[model samples]
Target chain A: MSGEGDIKLLGMVVSPFVVRVRMALHMKGVSYEYIEQDLFNKSEILLRSNPVNKKVPVLIHGGKPISESLVIVQYADEVWSGKGASILPADPHERAVARFWAAYVDDKLFPAYIGIMKAATEEARAEKAKEALVGLASLEEAFTQSSKGKPFFAGDSVGYLDLAVGCNLFWLEAIRKMFGVTFFDVGKTPLLAAWAERFAGTEMAREVVPDADSAVVFAKKLQARFGSNTSAK
Target chain B: MSGEGDIKLLGMVVSPFVVRVRMALHMKGVSYEYIEQDLFNKSEILLRSNPVNKKVPVLIHGGKPISESLVIVQYADEVWSGKGASILPADPHERAVARFWAAYVDDKLFPAYIGIMKAATEEARAEKAKEALVGLASLEEAFTQSSKGKPFFAGDSVGYLDLAVGCNLFWLEAIRKMFGVTFFDVGKTPLLAAWAERFAGTEMAREVVPDADSAVVFAKKLQARFGSNTSAK
Candidate 1:
């Protein structure tokens, strides 16, 4: 129920968690002030907003800050329920299913992604990619069940599970572009591979998700900052 | 809205997560069939119910399985909203806060608690306890803000954040009785220390939470099974 310009989102360009919130805003047509944070330098408001974890994707609504990516997305869905189709499924069972996959993305898949970036060599990167794909392969049935023969996890519309996985795909795309490490390998996770291409092509994803090339540069810088071992081999 | 027999909770008495679901059911005035699972030899129902995780604390409602403690608890709240006080707050911001703390319990607090159990040496156990207290100290502010001059996080009643942390307290109590490792140190986190006592004394907690003595025995057995190094000290 927030008026236009009343909402402000604190985020970084490279963070998939940030992208998830931006996508939710776009889907709901809730226009807000997007404050880009210099994560390396940190920001006063960002820290103040999310004092607990001190991370980004903090949505300032009516002067109250909501942090954590999943919580913020759910908050947006609840507060702006009338504005757009619900972000989470209306049915409790369906909602639980969406949440299960979302947690899976955060817990297993994201760490594997971080593993690729922080891995010292190409082989290590490949190993991380393989790990991520196994996680994705596990979700193939989830995608099938949630989609119900439709194109999205919400069945004809992008919903929580879609956004959860979709936001991370941009990073995967950038990794593939730079390191040739494929996450949505067509031969392995065919459905997710197709879904990735389709989701990335969407207007909301195109605008909200960080550009693959830009993310590639950022990824390189990120790896370099960690150590030269990342550049080794 | 589920009838007495319609809800089936798959769980173990020793699991804090399972205890959470039981607490929710009692609060909501809902009755369910409790199926105690053999964690070592998982039942066929448990396997079929939660194919993804195949873990305990799976709530089967109307033949649909909902896995994950947080998810199951939230699902229970949503599905039985009219029965009792809401598990999550009515306000979106409040809900977000509760979710954030629940997640914190899962991510940080639980792991630290586990560290104490898995630690081989008494010194290592103390170190883990110190780390856990640091995490608890951070939550003192959260309790103050969420409680807002009320006794509970949901203001005058047990709610999401309360159950999230409260369920874990029994384990801590067991650890305290056996290992003398205190999580809610009165000098360190006075509010949490007091809250833990108050929470455990409640009727819902007493009935649902596993007995501390039994948990202590379980803990000893668990540590012993891990290795003899656990007993060396």
Candidate 2:
């Protein structure tokens, strides 16, 4: 698995999920072909590669397609054990904690973000925005629980947990602009804000992340679509 | 952690998630005080233990509360390593695959089940039922990709994955009974069906799991409440 190193990734450049996989690869110093996807009309390769999920951030290493962003991150970490970055902690307890937080962010916090972005009315938007704020607050607490004054989510060095949770920061900023609200209070969640700033300023994030302006523009289009939709009513 | 030997679980007998933690502990051979909760009037311990989530299946080991069902399962597996059941696989790749499917079931498939159970209209009910079938179908495909010739999700032995995905089977049955439809075509998904039977019949499952009759009865009560609201409308 390690020697046959012709790695390829299929995903859109704009997706935060795609950026997650990109950041993992960048951190691990893995060379991979980045193929941009038109999600509206999915390519045959993307479809065939990920028949189950049929979503972006599919990693193909030596002809094996690994769907799911976090799963792909684990695969990258496994493949580049000694050569590059170690995304997972060696200790099982620490690794479990990292994974638990990662799952928590994806499962709980992410829905709030989605709800805020898709709310129909200003009232609904505000309600969802408030919930998102609470979720982010819990995440801030998790940062305090695990980091214990460390720089990253897992510890001093960036790991899988950071990439999984950190990928959503761009989406968070876009949602705030779209919904006309700010959930992240930098003063209150100083540690998390610092972590976000540090992770976002990394070479991987800077190189692979969608620009803030473009993300906001994309979010605005989604918001407009939700507004015009009869279903939203 | 093992030497402490003073673990207690606060939860109800009815919740599948509570059963998840119970199964993990049973499999791990971890001894604990099982305190049944009154969901209507929650105990102070339940509230104090899980302040953030304020939910059941809270594992208090060594007087520390670990909230969230899956998190508790992971904690049990880690803490009680020398116990009877090893919930998670030692191999990282196998563990990742197990976790991936478990998350898929929790996030995607279970929501479809909830939608079907809660649908007010016959048309909406049928549509949601169809979605649940599709979710199961995707799981069937995921099994084909990974499970292949394996007996359990993680080979011969039942692990964390079986417990996670298996907990949903009773809910599917309950939902199907409420809607007067069959979701899991035993003839179609033989392996999944067999696996479900295996999991349900396990001593751990038998001890903790409530009968499908009870779940259907509870679901019907909820549906009736909703139906009354619709009639008022």
Candidate 3:
């Protein structure tokens, strides 16, 4: 029977959501073997584990597979509650607020970013880019309130919301480089701009998050395979 | 200085999602003021509480507002952990699995139902209906695995996934009545069909979920305003 020591993660390196799960594992100080699944030819285990989505970032613990990054992250927090700092806040209200913003990152910010890339026309891409900025601006307000001059969204340390949003920083930077659409615009959201810098400089962020160049290259490969609306400036 | 007694809920009676939040509150036996919002002219509290979405159902506790039904439900579970049966399972794996299915209901089944309602063409509506059946079939399989032959998705008592999916049972029944689209098909998904009957008959389900006739009435009102592809059978 598989046990806690037998934890494994199935993921592709470039996916930001996959990166988010990895961050949670890191925060929890849990050791797990990384099984990189080739997206072109998906593994049978990946399909079996997540028959619903067949997507990456499936965490197999004690022979049971848990799918979805946020779900898996929450699972890690629950299972390894005492191993490291809890990913979510101890207070119920605070935890709910954190969850709210984390969801905003997935359901709003990332979609806006993806919308820009997937839009069929430059005008549409520009429109999505504007939405992306608005998303960032909202998060900027959230950061000022939540962080209280702290560097991370979880206050002092990297937490769930931090991983949720911070995982996309490199991708946003890549978008900036490719589309000339800035994410960390200091004039508009100075606190968030600074938060991004501080978050990216964290040791785990350095070790785990893929660089902007890699994200750009991977994105280009994807665009080459499936066309994109905008190209590098 | 507001306290626990200051709980207030801002919601519209017609929304299934809003009912889901109320079910959570009911399950927890948390009494609060129900502030019915005329969505045409949203209240200042609703606007202030949920600046991001500006939608219901917003749960206000001690002057702090939390938006989104699922998020509010989780908050209720956490805050009232000591009271009533815990909404989510104590076991991490169980909790994760429950969350996954709950998300599926929102991200898959509900959308499919909504698609049937909102589709511009009959052809598109039929396609969405087929997808909805496929989603139900998948959930039937999930019910078999997760329930371990128990009645509830949480396995005996009503819990998170039960409420998440069950909140839509009345709406689904209403759809079936209006459009002749069967959800609780006996032959294909006997377990789920049986489970639905059992869940819907539960005291809370009877109390919290709007009756199918009411849902049909609400849906007709919506369609009269917004237009629908499929009319009453």
Candidate 4:
């Protein structure tokens, strides 16, 4: 470790994963230098820090780089323990539930969203859209049950699962506007939708989450990039 | 939590994911009932416990079910803290590295292994085999750096990363035997190969990991199941 309080975040503005790291930092009231990375042409720092995946949202604390958004979030919680809101619960079972949902967001939800974005035909898009909705519905139920009638996934505070899911709200909204598709239905996923709104309204989210208009442009560009791949659907 | 020791693990015998949980339990000396579930025809209890994925290796403690292997491993480490060996590192950066590699095993290495197993043609198999080797080479480098001249990933003890990667040894050996192809070359991935041997020789691995002969039979059965899907490659 370097000197105390040395923290740097390497990420792109458009990436939901990066937003996750930012949200965690914001929740913890921890300050860090944010370095914007060009995804197309990655810098030496990005490549060196995360050699395995070479992906972004690398949290450099005390000169040590921690990659993977969730991993970074957990590291933040541990290192900055007793500072700001606790991302993961103190209870082991509750912590497991948070992790399970976070993994679900990456493993199931995001893939389903990507499937819709990559879909070539209307039929394929519809199928993928349905899958995405189903995933959102599951989150709705989780929020309904776990939130205890609170705004966030883990009660009143925006915890680990909240940051994991809520950080992607901009991207979700961008996709909705760009494709004229609704991934999270207000009626079906009322709790999750409400949580999204509550999360977006937070001071942390206001400061960290990317601008809506720019995110939509990025989403459109991403859709165009995926269009080149015929088998993406 | 339920009672003081009311823990039940729902798992399948041959699954590496299940073995991971078992390894954690064994290391922690946590006594729990292990119920083997049929993957082909999943039981109601299994489905009920893990409604989202409906997959195996669900840790049911105090009537609450925790799905996902890695999540369960972390939970075991936390709940049973100070009881036995700490699966995760105390240092934040070290813990992040462990989590990264464990995630890498799931997100990168396992997929490459699957690609090789699902390859239809010899040429495709050769390509996937090369990719799988590259992944193993990366793991070998990780072991060389992280092992610190010790046996396991987290030094003398078998920690999270060790259990994540090492538990799959039986499946790897089974695939090699069935296909008459080598995935982990002794010369190429000497560290990883040695680690595999070291892991398999351990008392825990010997007791938990399925026998090589039986694993081969299971591999053959899996191949047969995949045979119907011509586009598996």
Candidate 5:
């Protein structure tokens, strides 16, 4: 783990993925140059760094770039090991659990959230919202099981799982307002709701997380493009 | 990296996910009990161990279960570090690359392959097949760039990306035969084709990979259940 050279982050302001990387960097106390990219007209650096997905945030450390937010977060943890709060736990099983849940956020929860906002009809929206609640309930269970009375997913401090799921808070709140539906029920997912609030109230999160108003505006634009009877898939 | 207790794998025979765990175990030369589960009538162990996804390739080490194939593979590398051939590289950047490609296999290639085989009509199948080929081409580029003249994805040793992509070879071959279409074209993906052959021919792979005939049989059954226009998603 060497802090040898310049570090740069290629990202977009609106992306939750980008926010995840920023949170990880802040948690690790690593300094990096942040360069915002235009998603519609992606930069050469972004495209070259991540040709496969062509998305942000790409972390360029010492001239080499790493794509995928979770991947970059893991890289940051390894490269900056022992510098600050450890993102993943020491135990192998616990580390796997962290990865599994992180993957779950992307694989299951995000899609469900998008489905809720993008569904055409009220009935479809309700169904999608219900599905999203199911995913949230599972996440709530994860938080409860992983941290008994601790503040975050990986015990007392914010860790990998927190960064993974916390990025969605802005959009989740916006969807709650726009659709008049409560996905993270206090009765059902009390732990998750509390965790969400705690995560949002953190100084790092407050600084890094996109503004809720701006997030809502972005969500509305996304809905216009990806919502309704259109093939959002 | 202590080898302290009994290791048991709960898995289904036809699963590439299960195969991944098995390959990692064999690469590490770790002794483990392999217990095959019936997907139709899933065992209590499978359900109890991985209640979240309830899918197999759950590696139970010293009574704790680790779900998700790639996650388990990573756990194996960590727990059995310094034992045998390292699955992931030592460098953080290289490890991230390995992880990125492995995730790509799950996120992109597998889905495209499934889409090709499960499409409803010939036209849809052709389109899906083309999409799958596109993914394969990208994989080919990955292999070429990562390993210039080396044998495997990790340059000589059959590492993480090799196992991740190699597990799908059985099903890919089966699809080719069933559909009379060649997805892994020698002309288009010469390096990948050679790598696939090299990987398949490995002694470790011979022991872990499901036989082609058995894979085809399982694929047909899957096709019956998940194929055609009946909500493959």
Candidate 6:
């Protein structure tokens, strides 16, 4: 499977989640065909492969489709272990802790940020934005706890947990612009802010992440039509 | 650490998540203390132990506090490997796949369920209810694909991933009532619906689950103040 070209990823360039799958694959040095899908108008291949979710960041191996970004990242980590990048902790407990926070970021924080973007009044939006900062503050502490004295979320190298949490960094910036707030300030959240910067600068993440300008454009469009972004509605 | 009085879980009986920890403990036949806390007016011990998240379901073993349900479930599985119920697979790839969907249920699906419970409009609420079903349908297929001929989610015995995903079954009925919908029809989502019934009937789950009457009382309070649950706002 390592030498074969049977792996393919269905995703769009702008989705931070899709970028997460791409970054993990790149870090593992696993070659794969990247198929960009128009989410508004789905492709037959994408729909058939991922019939249940009908969403991007689906990894197809020989034909089996795996949806969910974190799932895709885990699949990549397990499939290419010890080849290029070992993206998961060897110790099971440490691995569980890493996974806990990754789920935390996706489960609790992102939706709060989405709420902030949808807030109607300036005062309401500001309050919502402040609340989001509090959530980020908790994440900062969690990162400090998980990373301890290491460079990445899991340990010495970027791993499953790091990739799972790292994808949300782009969304953090997007919400900051959307609500005129800056929650990821280094002074306030040094550990997590540094982690985000490090992840974005990584060769794998750099190759996959949408450029800052494009991200800003995406965020503004989402903000302008915040009410309609099914995610929040 | 496995000796008597060595492992203690600090939490109340009211929280489903804390019950998740308790269920895992019972499944593994691990002995532990059940400490109660007033979440609205949290105890100092709870705050210090889980300073990062300030949440319940904290597991203390050999003088260390491990917060988060999934992490604690994994810890329980690791410590009580062969006592009774063995959660989590030995094979790395199967373990990875299990962990992936467990994360999916907690991260993506549960939030959508929460949204449906909190929605202000009937249409918006119905839409979120559908989203929750979409998520459940994905889980249904994952169960079908992985379970194959088995009766459980991760095969013979209830695994960590099963505990992780199964923990939410009790809440589905209550949450569905809040949105005036039943997204998980036993007839429609046969695999998942049957899985939920099987998981719910377990002795551990049966003992901890709040009765239908209590669930109605709890959910009604949430409905009364649906717009004020500021966790997402």
> Which predicted model would earn the best DockQ?
3
Give the distance in Å from residue A56's predicted Cα in candidate 3 to where it truly belongs.
0.6
* Candidates sorted on DockQ, descending: 3, 4, 1, 5, 6, 2
Residue-by-residue lDDT tens digits, candidate 3, A104-145? 899899999988777888899889999999999999989987
Per-residue CA lDDT of model 4 for A1-233, tens digit only, reads 22337889999998899999988888788888889998779999999988988889898887888899999999989988978888998889889998999999998888887776677777887888788888898988788767888778888788899998987788777667656677666777777777787888988999888886788676566657755322221
On residues B187-209, what C-alpha lDDT tens digit does candidate 1 reach at each position? 87787777888898889987888
Per-model TM-score versus the true fold: 0.95, 0.86, 0.97, 0.94, 0.94, 0.78
Stronger candidate by TM-score (5 vs 6): 5
For candidate 6, write residues B123-200 as lDDT tens digits.
777788788888888888888877876878788667766777777766677665544467668877888777777877
**Deviation in angstroms for A87 in model 1?**
0.7
lDDT of each residue in A1-233, candidate 1, tens digit only? 34654788999988999999999988888988889998688799988998878899899987899999999999989988889768999998899999988999999999998788787777888888888878888888898889998888888889999999999887887777766776776787788778877888888987888777778777668667765334422
Whole-model Cα lDDT of every candidate shown, in order: 0.85, 0.75, 0.88, 0.83, 0.85, 0.74
Which residue pairs collide, candidate 6?
B87-B159, B88-B160
Expressed as tens digits, the lDDT of each residue in B84-191 for candidate 5 is 899998889888888888898898889888877677787888888888888889999889867767999999889999999999898888777778668767899988
The residue-by-residue lDDT of candidate 3 on B1-233, one tens digit each, is 12357899999887888989999988888888988998778888888999999999999998899987889999999998877678998899999998889888888999999888878877888898999999999999888878887888888888898888888888888888988889888999999899999988888877877778987887777777767654787
Best by the lDDT measure: 3
Candidate 6, TM-score of its B chain: 0.89
TM-score of chain B of each: 0.93, 0.89, 0.95, 0.92, 0.93, 0.89
Model 2 has an lDDT value of 0.75
- Total colliding residue pairs, candidate 6: 2
Those runs of model 2 whose alpha carbons end farther than 4 Å from true positions after fitting are: A1-4, A78-83, A89-96, A175-180, A220-233, B1-4, B81-85, B89-93, B220-233
Q: Candidate 1 or 3, higher lDDT? A: 3
lDDT of 4 by residue, B1-233 (tens): 22347899999888889989999988888889889898789999999999999998999998999999999999999998978889998888889899998998998778876676677777887787787788888998889877999988999978889999987888777667656668667888888888888888988888788876676666567768866222321
